[model samples]
Target: MEHLAELDKKHFIHPTSSIQQQQANGPKVIMEKGEGIYLTDINGSEYMDAMSSLWNVNIGHGQDELAEAAAEQMKQLAFSSAFSTFSHEPAIRLAEKIASIAPDGLNAVFFTSGGSESNDSAIKLTRHYWRIQDQPERRKIIGLKRAYHGVAAASTSATGIKEFQEMAGEMMTGFVHTETPYEKTADEAIHDLRQTIETEGPDTVAAVMAEPIQGAGGVLIPPDDYLRQVRALCDEYGILFIADEVITGFGRTGKMFGVENFSITPDLMTFAKGVTSGYLPLGGVIVSDHVHEMLKEKSKGTLFHGFTYSGHPTAAAVGLKNIEIIERDGLVENAREMGGQMLRAFEKVQSELDIVGDVRAKGLLGAVELVQDPATNKRFSPDQQAAPKVIDQLHERGMICRPVSFEGTDIICFAPPLIINREQVHTMVEKLHDAVFAVQKELQVKG
Candidate 1:
């Protein structure tokens, strides 16, 4: 603990962490390793990785085969470029594999370092494709409020969470925002979206981006017909639809992609996170043939958009192998099966808790939202960190679950590894139940 505290206080700069609190109380450091769906800290504490290590780690942790694959690639060709006049076999093979798995008509791939960069690339491609089609005026990209795209400029513009933008002091141009379909009827949400488009005018709108199931936005599962309605709305408005599958891709939602889970195809899809299971940084955009062909044929100039690490060989090799493992191990099928069991467990627990507002689950992804009064459907005040307290208690009880507080609501997200089994799910629920009891006690004491 001495070494951990010293390092965290002196050197570690964490993302989305409260640095002041961290410096005062030190970090929650995991010293050693993980295997399958479990992790052991330096203090010999074993816990379930309930959030799948930030909703990645699809194939779970400590797969020696993955390590060996990465090691062998490093030995043979540690680094290479995929820029013009230079392309690698692994990159080509991975691209082909991605194209095969991606929805029909999305035949082209442009790689990036992670989800953020992939989303950024999608923004650029959307505008670029529109420009090539001689509609440079169609540059307004609409994103749902509370959506989490990424922290980069363009991607952040597509991000609707207020905290990400509050300190930035401003927003990027050409990024329009609409209400998320969460907690709203599909028809009403669609009507509101139509109104937004009318207010902005369709000619000014270029693309509309969404998550099939809002992952970072409190794991909000919309009405069943929402994505289909969004598709129809996009088609009617002549707007390209982009599915941001950063958290839901690669079998997280019990499907290879979230778009498949909802049965709605987008013109473009951005993927990252589980692609390489966070073992390597790899992400990209899958463009429809229409957009791909337009950019290839009608484009007047060079693509002029890419990263120095685009299609990094080592990452591509790892990603290719990752996809293979996901397919071979039948993790997607497992996710679907375990998801049913997990949702039932949550439902049973939900029935016992008066504070439980909503119990939503799809595939391996699920959430249990808290409220002030369930009968009245009254939510707790946004200032109440009820979910965060539960998250902290869960960690103390030897598990990791994300307490999503987007828009000041309490939704505890459960996204375990696809490799998790029924026993692990039971263990996770038991620990979460204990944590919820403890949090309720704490809230009572505070009150």
Candidate 2:
């Protein structure tokens, strides 16, 4: 413990980590390695990586091939700037490969370092695109309530979760938020979105940004027709549609892209996280042909928007190889098949546990919602800290799962790697089942 504290104090300033918690309890220092869907700590304790290291490691952990690709790229030419008339082969090839897999009409790519950077770029580029098209007034960006876009100023503004905005002092002006489609019926949600647009004036609305499944927002899965309606509405209002697939890209949701899972295409799509299976940082925005042509024909001089590491050769090479592994290994198809099995496992929990409120799963992504009274669908009081307690119990049992912090409710999200099989799903479920019971016994004692 002393060793761990010394290391964190000297070298780490963690992201999204609670400083108070760290000060009190130190870190869960994971040294050693992982394979397929399991991680072993320094003490030789094994835990199924049920959250896929924050839902990113799609192809699984500790794959030697990814390391080989990185090493090979480093040996050849590790660094190349994509600035002004300079281009690298890996970057060019990655752009082409991404284009081949993107939805129809989305043929252009602009690279960034990660999801936050990609979102930041998208916000700037969307506004720039509209200005070039002579619609500068269309600057209002609409995001769904409970959405998790990113952490930067503009991206956080584009985000719908209030928790990310709590310390920011003020909300971004003209950044509108509406109820998510999952909160109501598809038509009702559409009606509410239309009302928001009407209230704000559609002429001022530049775009509607969304995730097909709200991955960080407690795995809120929209109705099957939600994306279709959203696409139609965006077209009706002439608002650019942006799908934030940072968490759902690269077969996390059993599809190459989460938007593809719903069969709806967007005007712009932002991707990161699973692109290189979290082996390297790479993110980008895919633009539709109309937006692409407009930016090309109207914008003079490089669009004035890019990063120093845009399409970094090393990241691009890793992504190319990662996509190859996914294709060669058939991980996407496996996710679809195993996801069904995992969802079925939830039925046993629902049948046995009185605390279960709802079970939602897709591909390798899922969440089990806990309520005080499952019969009446009444939620547990937020002060009870039920979800965190369950997380602690699961941790003690040597499994790593994340508690969904949105809506102040108890939701345990599960996102194993796409490579996880039925046996691994069973292992995770068994561990979770025991943890849930342990929490229940404690809560009963407290009551």
Candidate 3:
């Protein structure tokens, strides 16, 4: 184990991690196994996976069903290119199954390796659709501020987070961003979208892409009618609406898709993460019939956008089994019930802890905002590093979650496995409360 840790430190380049910290501390916990909502590290210490391993793993872990499905497909037909009229049953079946469960009219599927590729494909498809319609100038894509798309060129440009865009140098042009609907009524937020569109010239705009609920942007849940209003506006202006469901799809939000929570249909929907419960890499975009038919009738030649592993049979087989388990175990219903329990528990913590500034939740997706002054919602100074400190305390307490510090505020977010039970929810909240209290005590001492 020590030798492996040394090798990881020497050779591995981890994503979204601090290189200095990795070189200094090496790997903190080497996870060995996972079951249900708990993970066992190499040292045999157990931790409640409160963040669901980057907000995927909806069906928990250590399920032999998904493994068996993958092995079965591998033995029969593992590798095949989903290109130039070549097709496979697993891909065909999975696409049909996804369309059956997707929001109305989004009946066509385009597979990708993961969320980033799915989003990137959506961008290219949107632009291609416009070009085919003879409106080649309609190339601009608009996104909500604080929104996370992906790391690809087009996806990064569509992302509203400035840090990501800056990391990649000058982003691809023709992408703009508008204000998020946080703390605003639906009408007010819709007005902001309209203003951006009017300012950008609707003729030049191609699509308005947004998450039904912004996950990485601190679990921001907009007003109830926010998406509906946005859909209406996009329709009115002939702009396509793309719902990035990478984090919210497949029962994470207590619904089949996040858009169902708002009863709005998107022209294009990008999904990943929970499709195979993180057991396998798989993602795709569900194209609305409107867009699909347009491509069918107007396209001159072939659609040139796709990934090599777009329709990997092994991954598709696992996705099929994952969906079956989610349905058979009634995990979606459990997410709704347990999510409510988690929110109520968070509210109780907020009432008890002055450091807890706000608590917001939707289904299993939730966040606990920490602040220096609850009375005025004043955030902790960046130098304090309050969020990471609290998260460190949580790790010591055997609960794993994410510390989100975006837009100058610190928040600890949770997205436990959908199979999590009431008792586990209570335990998670108890540990979170203790962690926050520990941070608060440290702050008081420093003062």
Candidate 4:
């Protein structure tokens, strides 16, 4: 373990992590094994996987079926690119399965390696569809503020998080951000969207992209009617709706996709993460029939956008098995039921702890907002590191959670595996309660 830690420090560069911290502390924890809602590190300390790793892992961890499926496919045919006219059965079946389960009209699939690539492809596909329709100028995309898209060029540009865009240095351009409906009225947010589009000129605006629930942006759920209004607005402007379901896809949101909760079918839905539960990296965009027909009939030779590992046979096979397990075991319903218990648990935490300013959940995806003054919802100063401190307390107590301390906010996010049971939900939230309580005492925040 020490040797591996040394090697990781010397050679490996972690994504979106502090290099200084990595150099100071060799490694936080080397995870060795995982089971339902539990992860055991190399030191043999077992902890609840409260954040589902990176908000994926809907099926939990160490599933034999997914491994067997991958092994079987690899032996038969490990890889064969989906480029040009060539394709394989695994890719075809997975795409078909996604279509059948997806919201209506999004029947066609274009593959990518993961969320970033999927979103990048979706942005390009939107433009490509418009270009083919002789609306080449309809290339602008409007994203919601605090929306977390992905890190690739176009995806980064589309992402509403200022930090991500700043990190990418110069944004790819043709993208604008509007205020999110989170923590506010939908009418005002919708008006902002409308105003932004009109200001950018309706014809130049190609699509409006967003996550059904802003996952990485602190699990901030919008008003119930927000997405519906956005859909109508998009339709009014003849603009495409791109749903980035990278984190909220599959059973994580108590539905196959996050948009289902809002009863909205986006024009193009980009998905990854839970499709294979992180067993392997696989993601894709599901396009509407109109978009599909446009590309099929009008597009010139070579649509010409895809990753080499796009539609990977092994990954696709695992995805099929993953969805099968989700269906057969009724994991989506499990997420819904367990998620209710978790939210109630969080509400209980908020009621009892003054530090817990707010709590919100959409299925397993949830967050507990920590604040300095609960009555005013006044946030703690940055130096306090309230969210990370609570997360550290959770870590010491044998549980893992994510901190959403971005942009002067202190939040602890949770997305336990869909397979998590009622007892596990109760226990995890109980631990979170204890952790927050401990942090409250440490920070000396008074009621």
Candidate 5:
């Protein structure tokens, strides 16, 4: 453990981590193995993977089927470039599978290496689509506040998180952010969206991207009609809607995709993470039939944007097998059931504890907002670090989860593997209860 920690600190810069923290504490936990809904550290300490390792492992930690698929494909043909009209069977078959299962009208795909690349591709492709339609002025891409797309240049610019953009110095032009429906009523939110569109000049806008449910933004769930209204508004203005489903796709949201929960068909949808359950990095933008047709019919030479790993044979094979497992085992339905059970568990804990402000869950994704006083909705000071304290307690108790303290809100987030069962749900909640209780006692003493 010490050897690995020293190497990690000296040579590796972890993604989305505090470098100083790594220097101070080394690696938080050196994971040695993973299976079902749990992971084991190098020292043999087991932990329930409550956050699914950044909410991507929808099917769970270790699945033999995906490994076998990758191996079998690699033995036959490890890779073949899908560039300049070159193609391969794995890419073709996976694209067909994605088209068959994606939301209606989204029947075409352009592959990428992962969510960041997928989102970046979607932005470029949307602008290209408009360019083909002879609207060269349509280049602006608007994303929702608190929405997380990816870490690539375009995706980073499209993200609503201030820290992400600030870290990148100055962001690129043509990216705008608007308030989310979580902060406003559905009607008001739609009005705000329409106003943003009008202000941006509808003729100059290429697409408006959003996460159906804000996952990293504290699991903020909008009203039932919020997305539907947004879809209608976009249609009314002749602008494209892009659902950034990197976290919510592939049965994580109790459906094949998150947009289905709202019954809306985005012009373009970007996905990754659970697409292959993190076994292999693969992601793509599923284009609508009309958009695909227009690009096919009117596009000029070379659509041009692509990744070297795009349509990688092994990753594509693993993605196919991953989807097979998700369907065959009925993990999507399990996420729905387990999600409700988890929500009820959260509510029960909230009822008994005033510090738990609000509990929101959709499918296996959920969050518990921490408050100082629920009746008044008063928040604990930032110095208290209430959510992180509770999360640390959970970690000490052999459960892994995330604490979200974005924009003055303290939230504990969870997105357990879809394979999690009722007993596991109860166990997670029990540990969470104890964790929150322990933290509250510490805070009381400190106060």
Candidate 6:
């Protein structure tokens, strides 16, 4: 195990990881297996998967059914290109299944390998749709500040997170970002959207893309009517509304899609993550009937856009069975119920702990904001790296969660599997309480 860890440190290039830390610490936790909501490391230590392994393992882990599905499809037909009239049963059936559960009028599916490709595809398709309408000047894509689309060119350009852009060097042009709705009420945000449209000249804007609840940006949940109002604003300006549901789709928000929670229909919706419960890589964009109709009428030649693994048969097969598991096992309802319990647990922790500033949860997605002074909402010094310290304590206490140190605040985020039960929720809360308390004690001792 030590030799393998050394090999990982020497050869593996991880994403969104600190290269310096990886070289210094080698591999922190070399996981060997996962079952339900817990993971076992190579050394036989267990830890609760509070973050659902990058917020994608909605069905938990170690599901033999998904493996069986993949194996069955591989035996029949392993790979096939989705381009040029070539199609397969798994891709066709998965698309049909996704469309059936998607929002009204969103019945067309364009498959991608994962979230990044799905988002990038949406951007290209949106601009192409406008060009087909003979409105080539409508090329701008508007996104929300603090939003996280993906890492690809178009997706990263649409992202409002500055770090991604800085690391990736220059970003693409014609992508504008507006203030998040959390800065004000839904009505205020609507007003701001109107101002942006008027300032940018609405005719030049092709679409306005946003996440119903910003996942990586600290799980920022907007006002209940924010999406509905955004949909209206897009319509008023003749702009397409795109919902990036990569993290909140496939029952993460206790619904098939996050837009469903807001009772709004977007022209395009990008989805991934929980689509296959992270059993395999699979994602796609759901096109509204209105948009599809326009493409059919205005476009003459081929779409001229697709991926080599757009609809990998094995991934689609796993997705099919994964969805069946989610539906049959009632995981969505479980997420809602468990999320409520988690919220109440966090409320209790906040009332008892002085460092706990705020607690928020929607379905199974949640965040615990830590502050130096709860009364004043004072943040810890950046040098303190308080969130990471608390996360280390969580690891010591046999739990795994993410520390979000962005937007001038430190927060611990949680997104446990949808299949988590009441007992697991209680255990997670208890461990979290202990971890936070430990961090508080260490801080006090240092002071």
Query: What TM-score would every model get versus the actual structure?
Result: 0.97, 0.97, 0.98, 0.98, 0.98, 0.98
Q: What is the lDDT of residue 168 in candidate 6?
A: 63
Better lDDT candidate (2, 5): 5
Q: List the residue pairs that clash in candidate 3.
A: none
Tens-digit lDDT string for candidate 2 (193-267): 999999999999999999989988899999999889989999998899999989988888888888888899898
Report backbone clashes per prediction. 0, 0, 0, 0, 0, 0
Q: Give the per-residue lDDT digits (tens) of candidate 4, residues 225-247.
A: 99999999999999999999999
Candidate 5 Cα outliers beyond 4 Å, as residue runs: none
On the 0 to 100 scale, the lDDT of residue 404 in model 1 is 80
Worst 10 residues of 1 by lDDT: 438-447
Provide the RMSD of all predictions against the true structure, rounded to 1 decimal: 1.3, 1.3, 1.0, 1.2, 0.9, 1.1
lDDT (tens digit, per residue) of candidate 1 on 100-139: 9988888889999999999999999898888877888998
Residue range with the least summed lDDT across 10 consecutive positions in model 3: 181-190
* Model 3 RMSD vs true structure: 1.0
Give the candidate number with the greatest lDDT: 3
Error of 6 at 311 (Å): 1.1
What clash pairs does model 2 have?
A: none
Which residue pairs in candidate 4 collide? none
Please write out the lDDT profile of model 3 over residues 1-447, one tens digit for every residue.
Answer: 788889989999888888889999898889999998999999899999999998999999899999999999999999799999699999999999999999889899999989999999999999999999999999999999999998988888988888888886866899988888876677777888899999999999999999999988889998887888899999999999999999999999899899999999999999989999999999999999989999999988777877899999999999999999998999889899999999999999999997899898999999999999999988888889999999999999999999888778798999999999999999999999999999999987886
